[model samples]
Target: MTDLATPGSAGLLNGKRLLITGVLSDMSIAFQVARIAQEQGAEIVLTSFGRALPITEEMTRLLPAPAPVIRLDVTRPEDLERLPLEVTRHLGALDGIMHSIAYAPPGALGGRFLDTPWQDAATALHVSAFSLQALTASCADVLEDGASVVGLDFDASLAWPGYDWMGVSKAALEAVARYLALYLAERHIRVNLVAAGMIRTVAARAIPNTDHLETIWRNRPPLSWDVSDPTPPARACILLLSDWLSATTGEILHVDGGLHAVMT
Candidate 1:
């Protein structure tokens, strides 16, 4: 197991203010990123919506410092419109934003690709792909010059057995990041993504045939891939959020233990 550094020991994000979304539980990648960001000296505000709000709120208590949770349902136009004021009320101008949100309904995932209804597929694309644009644009007024935007991603280059509509959504996400990077460049804002290997998160477990995907990662990567631990990808997110990668944008940094490079 790779040892996670003590929070705040590195100070990589010292004095930064960030808005992080998609933290449903401690097991989530966003949770770890928020935890480490606080340890590294960032003041972060988190977002959750509806029934999951309380769950995300509870997870914040486990962070190095408890962060305030704001309600944001990306699919709701009202929520997106109010996001800037809500975020500004908590943390003034943002230095970074973490786009860790994605979802596909039961009807859209788990080998239901051919049988899935158009509504189900559209919902998946709207929530998983277009939400990045919605969230960023909503927060644009509050984003500081040179702010960084990082989104979590699964490799969409090849189809995984049961990934289904979520796979299509991810490909859309990559394209969105590139366009955001191009347009946001005028403000010196950087937009990038981290394509990660499977980790045993609540979200990952929801995808069908995850066991098969995990097995492939375990066997193919040149480097040892731990599906149990999320530290590596969390660290990559922190790096992108920091000033160290000022020149990098519209890029997908793979923290997938070399599985992305090896052909099966």
Candidate 2:
């Protein structure tokens, strides 16, 4: 569902281009962003990895028009090195990047933090936290002067029932966003995060007892909460990426139906 008020020319993202990662299915937050961004006149591309490539290629075929899917497994040096070149080849210079990638090994979640191994912890940090920095640095040269960088986040302020290492990874992700915002200010680039509430995405499915977390939100949020829909958070991301938020950076804009602001 798009707002009809937006013009064909003054599209929220006219002439702007964005690269979105972590789009595995139509229910993905990245998928929502890609759809809306294109509807608003932004050129877009998707990135996938390894055996997941065919899945991404299949998904893109569902879009209104076909868009390129580039290879990017953030931890792989070669993939990161070629990302900018690949995007430029398909979509020209980047005006925005969506760091929607994050992962944690099975052993790292659903237990005491102390039980987590360094290897698993390190994997979480690299994929969930450091990937943001890697994506930004790799594409920095091609990023337009007022480029915006956005990532999907879940609040890491406290421990959760089964989030374990992923909770820690989220904390690191937040810090990385702030540091990037500070450092990239000189380049007229903005870095920010949308700390969205849990939605039933493929990534969220990895978290143990995620449905319990969603059930809790149904009764607690100030505004209505919908665990099934990620469009609200997706739209919020487009706002932060657009020129409308030129002055906003290093901020965590919560799109959790106001849950993060209230206390029981």
Candidate 1's residue-wise lDDT over 4-96, tens digit each?
Answer: 444555588888999999998777999989988987888999999889999999998899887899999999999999999988799988999
Q: Listing every candidate in turn, what is its Cα RMSD in Å to the true structure after a full C-alpha superposition?
A: 1.7, 1.5
Cα lDDT, all candidates? 0.92, 0.89
Q: For candidate 2, what is the TM-score?
A: 0.96
- Report the lDDT tens digits of candidate 2 across residue range 86-181: 987987899999989999999898775788889999999999999999999999889998899999999888788889999999999999999999
Model 1 / residue 84 / CA error / Å: 0.8
Question: What RMSD value applies to candidate 1?
Answer: 1.7
TM-score of each: 0.96, 0.96
Clashes counted in candidate 1 amount to 1
After superposition, which runs of candidate 1 have C-alpha atoms over 4 Å from their true positions?
A: 1-10
